[model samples]
Target chain A: MATMPASPAAPSSDERLARTGPATRIMRRPEFGAAIGAIVVFVLFALVDSTGKFASLDGIARWTDSAATIGIVAVAVALLMIGGEFDLSAGVMIGTTGLVLGLLVTEVGLGIWPAILLTFVFAAAVGAMNGWLVVKTRLPSFIVTLATFFSLQGINLGVTKLITGTVRVAGIDRGAGFDSARAVFATDLWEPYRFRIAVIWWIAFTVIATWLLTRTQFGNWIFAVGGDANAARNSGVPVHRTKIFLFMGTAMSAALVGIMTALRLRSVQAGQGVGQEFTFIIAAVVGGCLLTGGFGSAIGATVGASIIGMAFIGIAFAGWNTDWSFLFLGLILFMAVMVNTLISRRASAGATK
Target chain B: MTTLSEAPVPTGEKILELKDVSKSFGSVIALRDISLHVEAGSVTCVLGDNGAGKSTLIKTLSGVHEPSTGTYEVLRKPVRLSSPRDALALGIATVYQDLATVPLMSVWRNFFLGSEPTTGFGPLRRLDVKKAKQIARDELLRMGIDIRDVDQPVGTLSGGERQAVAIARAVYFGAKVLILDEPTSALGVKQSGVVLKYIVQAKERGVAVIFITHNPHHAYLVGDRFFLLNRGRMMENWTRDEVDLDSLVKAMAGGAELEALAHELESLGGAAASAAEEVADVVSHPTRGEDTR
Candidate 1:
């Protein structure tokens, strides 16, 4: 019997083999494709717009306002996706929150501030319910949140008609706290430019969400829970807590959008935000957040919403019917996803040693 | 002090010990009558084939399963561990075959998944990204794992490199007994050698390393003590001086079974010579060249 020799590779291989250069490191970022797509879409819209208004401040604000509403929800959904869950109820939750606030202020004879606060509480409960059901049942969050989406859609329509005898509720501005609530949620800024306050909230949300996702311990947990929940649980990460918070956070973001819409219109329609959940998901995927989870960033979703906003308003500026925007969005999603898949394939193969 | 083989034998205090340990699920005994001692500053290789109770032995030791009989001791003190967390608290970190890493996360994040370094105060406290990245780089460098960039996603790493990173993490976290579950089972020759090198480094750092692998070549190269398991039973145990590579392989391949086959093949003589070599290669490299069979 031969005694085995020690490995010659036993000599220290720890010489910092070859540090990845800045360029390669940049390419590996989950949002790299989204950043490029945002720029390309911006340039294409600028070139196509016949009125040259797409380049102007007000036009930028017009799309940014649209983008901000979608951006706020997209950011939360991005984090949810990163944490390996989804909130299909996000769209209708917006309508539900708004209708809740509208009915409380008008029918229940409550002040606007109290009504808004109660609406947030209700939204948080719904979000918690969605998360608890997903974790407890071990069901795919897709199925769980899908059920939530249908239930909330029914509540938004049924509850509104049941109380008001109409599909819409109006006159929320007549409440005592209406002036302050409008200032907080619906106030216009840079009046000449027609900028909505939602843009500021959107930017703030993106920055805070970006910081939380990339710069905090909770952020690391988000990646872990999504990457492999079993591994994350074995590693002693609070996987359930991380997931629950994300679900609740996403629901609250939708509620904020709902508040903004209700305050702006002083009315709430039963079907106001129906079918918009797909829009938020579209922005997230376009921003490079993988639907499978564990590989996306909040900033990527923000960029994705920006792209959507540009397409929505840019199509109109270019003298085309605004209905073409959905077709335009489908094209961008396919193109961005294709680009992302190609890049990630190369990035995953980038291990040099 | 240095007579020849520098590899230390199982001496000094035992970091972990199993005495007449047996585990079972109903009537199915996964492990029975297995006794082993892992001493500090040594590599103890657990050798076995597919159903040789290796995983059962691992689970029993790592607090994944409670032994049905006998005592398991940590640092000479007999105790019971309810979960992996309890074992980890006692510095018995197990780097399983999968490495338990988040592939999309950066190396630093993966390095400190459960235990993150924090700075600042209260709500302002964050991950301390700069410190985490630096420590991840430094700790891996200590293990002689030449990582390219700490910021790169861990999925981009080779299998061996990822294992090295996991091992380094265990060491940095002050693990006294590092349990590596089939660290080289999924690696090629060159990559396996890379991991084997780190096993030596880990031992030199005074860790009682439990190196689990079926490959006799890897086990023989670094293993100072060997415990052979077959069908949920301890077939034999030997120190470095008592066993060599061929015997280890024969035992791992089931000594009686291989001998019977050897005798049967001898009857076939010259025509079976190539077939015997093929079997030898398959036995030697259990992890590779499997498709040919």
Candidate 2:
């Protein structure tokens, strides 16, 4: 954190910065603080857990599995945020997509393969609607997605009860093509220690997202639109297209998590994934995403999710109530932000002189 | 619409000619009777005070806003631009007052931005990292901009360097007509000189540069043709041989100096004239003083 520049700096030091000065190099990365935070939290968990199992390979698998779902959504949320918008309906859309898939398989008697395809299209359409509404109305995405959040929440509950008379939908395993779907989405991997396929999905998503953000034309536009939209628009960037794609991407990622959950548990509740939007948002922010937008990384969100995972399982392993995880994450988030701010400020101040 | 034209092949030609162009934002008029010609290999400056419709003229030319009236000729053919992209399609690029460069993004990324060079196809398509870096470096070098690294965030560059990078990018992307909005308005004296140097460099490379500024000194340093705008109208037009630094400054001041001179004369003469009258009248009116009272 001490290495990153805090403010915009003059061009002379830029020469030295190009040489990879430790301080200048670190300041360039928005996620440096988050990386450090993740490391600290991991070490603390390993050292303090009363059960030594927290340090084992199985423990790594346990925490990683917990982190995978949130990590997947958080990275996409981070990208959307970098493009300067929010998708508040993400958590609810998870429920919405999952329920739609569950019902199609259980009641509609559709194969998992077909059900999944329909579910994806459904989620994408809803996402496209959210993006379109945001661009057309020129409303703050917070307000826009909030409307979506409430709407989807109602639909998930109302339609589920209307069809099943119960909040939960089960018998997903009995549906045709369930085994293959599980193999793709919910299977366990590695011989001795079972790891969820979702973890592999999370890693792949992060890599692709990172490449898309940092190594593509679209990635450049993401930063431009987020930093200043009018300026970006004036520069010939298709600002609306960039934003809409981002919104759709976020929703689709959440839907992937929804599919994985239903396939693994063999059921999805009507209220599934409700009120969990904040977790994805918090994880992104903790991963070094700027709340104001235009600055963050996909890897950073992944690192942030690991912090949450560590706290969730570490508290349990240390013989403490798992509820302490929330308090622990909250404190870590505040500290990470403070550390990042202080370091960047100093780096910028030094550059001007 | 010459997207196929390559850089370093600039033709010494008339690129953009605007005649009596006018723009109104609903009820408020921003520009009227605006006429200017930007010639390739020359620096044409649009000079104005704050709110003097410089931005409107820029927007109109760069395709951000279409002129409500008059003919905007590109490459000797009149056309109405629907968007900045349209203007770019015709080889007209605008560098705005609030620069479009993303501060958190690397220099190379900001340079290639919308027209980024990429390889492969579809979802597998990725930016040509080496090519982009090389070009960014080469372009900056061409502009005489000494950037230490292409990967550094653009915000680290001083105001002047950033403007230089924007100019270099405009040139590298084959912009025949470059419109700069207050490029040196936010720069220091030396930094302003640096940007002025790049304006000349662009001109040497045969790019028609429109350098907009409120600073007469900066304009005089590089401008070959100057257009003075005020209150939505063209106040004055001067070629390089026709205008001097003093006249340019005086015009930009909008008669403030003349008004101040009149005020100074009124106070200086009134006190002296009144005092002389009192002494002369006292002597001349001594005999009639008792009667006058």
Candidate 3:
């Protein structure tokens, strides 16, 4: 038998490694570009604000309120993207779930809490259906969820108009347990500034999603399935199950935002969340999620949402045409992705050297 | 450290045996009348060119495909395998050329990809990141892989280092019989040497290694016993003492086929034919250092 090396040899010439410094290491993270982008956008808006309130605590509350709803769903969409799937149905799922909540409370005469519970069950069923179809049919999730998007869009308008004789549902404030439900989902916290409770929910979801991605077995599976599905399956990872659950997660988070929006407005519109799916995807991509899959961060998605939120409020405060906002967002996406790609290339190259 | 078994199993114990194996896909025969045995602390090299039934043999051994007629045995007891997982459960692990690793993932994460260890209770449980990283670093070091950082992505590693990672992973996961498919085919001269070193390291640790390669030089360097496969048949089987490098190369190249090619070239050309004849002579009478590259 061969003896163990008598002592750990000095760093050999053949495998001499050049370890990274703190700055390079930090820049190597998948979310670093998004983090930097968030700061730059904040500073640029702060410099150009015409309405002095745009830089105040009240403005912070207003912009974060806009970001929170998008951030909530964006976090889950980020997870689904990392697991290598897309849910085009996420945006329409909001309208569908809100209509369900509004109908259950106003027409079915159920308590606000029970109606909310039934809405979640409905959302889960749709999510599960999206997941099952993607796994069993082996079709691209983009195609399957796109079909779901169109179907749900039709159902949102058709079912709401058929029952309520209008394109919207109202009188949610008169339903049983309205006071308690509003306190949980729609209440404004803190005096003077009156920050919305949804911001806290958004922050909490971000924390949980980050923990799930970084510190859990499920998180590892997400990265694995996204990185290389064949390698993962050969290594005994449950590829299909992980992917299905990611689809379900995106659907369910959309439902949460739907319920919150319905509660805050005390009404639901058929087209309330229509066309918002692209917004969630934009937030995720700007946050450094790869369209191809396997590499991203949840906090990055949150940062991306905040950047959008700032742009929306900042543009209005600067008295610029709101139409220019989309152009600015497109530019932001391109720049964030470019910086992320370059930094990642350098990080990997430096590590090997 | 917790899973490392320092005491090697006694040598010369036959760990795996395939008896009278023949596999046919529909009407086409892929492998016919094949038999081989692997022992503890030894390397069995299976040498074949492309489409020489090497993949079929590997599949049959690793349970990706079942032999049409054979008794596959492990530890002298016949066992039927239905899937790759079944083979893995029985301590038979196959590392393909790609090495079954996600390149973008960190080394520690890829090391514990499928079977991650978690610590804590109920919903509060989490991946034991510190333990996984430590064990991954230690196990790789034990295999002489000496990776400085377990956090580096697997893509940053060289081809040979990735092979070492895969080998080390299989060993740490309690593989008794490791099947390596062309581990050196994509590597350079130095990288091939590195992978060959790890194969020897694995053999010395008492793991039965079945190395499948197309290169005779690589096979002859570390192989204890050699099996030559040609056209879905076992043409020759010899122990290290019974064969030398030149004969091994000659058998693999089919000496008659080379001679015929040399003759064919002579009739077709003048300068090129002379060059071809000279090349054939060097191949037929290979010098030790001259042919290794």
Every candidate's chain B TM-score: 0.87, 0.86, 0.90
Instruction: Estimate TM-scores for all models.
Output: 0.90, 0.91, 0.92
The candidates, ranked best first by TM-score, are 3, 2, 1
**C-alpha lDDT values of all predictions:** 0.84, 0.83, 0.87
Q: In model 1, how large is the Cα lDDT of residue A16?
A: 39
TM-score of model 3's chain A: 0.94
Stretches of candidate 3 off by over 4 Å are A1-15, A350-353, B1-9, B260-283, B286-293
Compute the lDDT of residue B66 as modeled in candidate 2.
85
lDDT of 2 by residue, B185-273 (tens): 77776667777888888888888889888887778878888989998899888988898776776676654544455455556676755
What proportion of the real contacts between chains A and B does each prediction keep?
0.53, 0.45, 0.55
Q: Give the Cα error of residue B94 in candidate 1, in Å.
A: 1.0
Residue pairs with backbone overlap in model 2: A4-A27, A6-A344, A6-A345, A6-A348
The docking category that best describes candidate 2 is acceptable
Runs in model 1 deviating more than 4 A are A1-20, A347-353, B1-11, B261-293
The candidates' interface RMSDs, in order, read 4.2, 10.7, 4.5
The candidate that achieves the highest TM-score relative to the unseen native structure: 3
Per-residue error (Å), model 2, residue A210: 1.7
Cand. 3 Cα-lDDT: 0.87
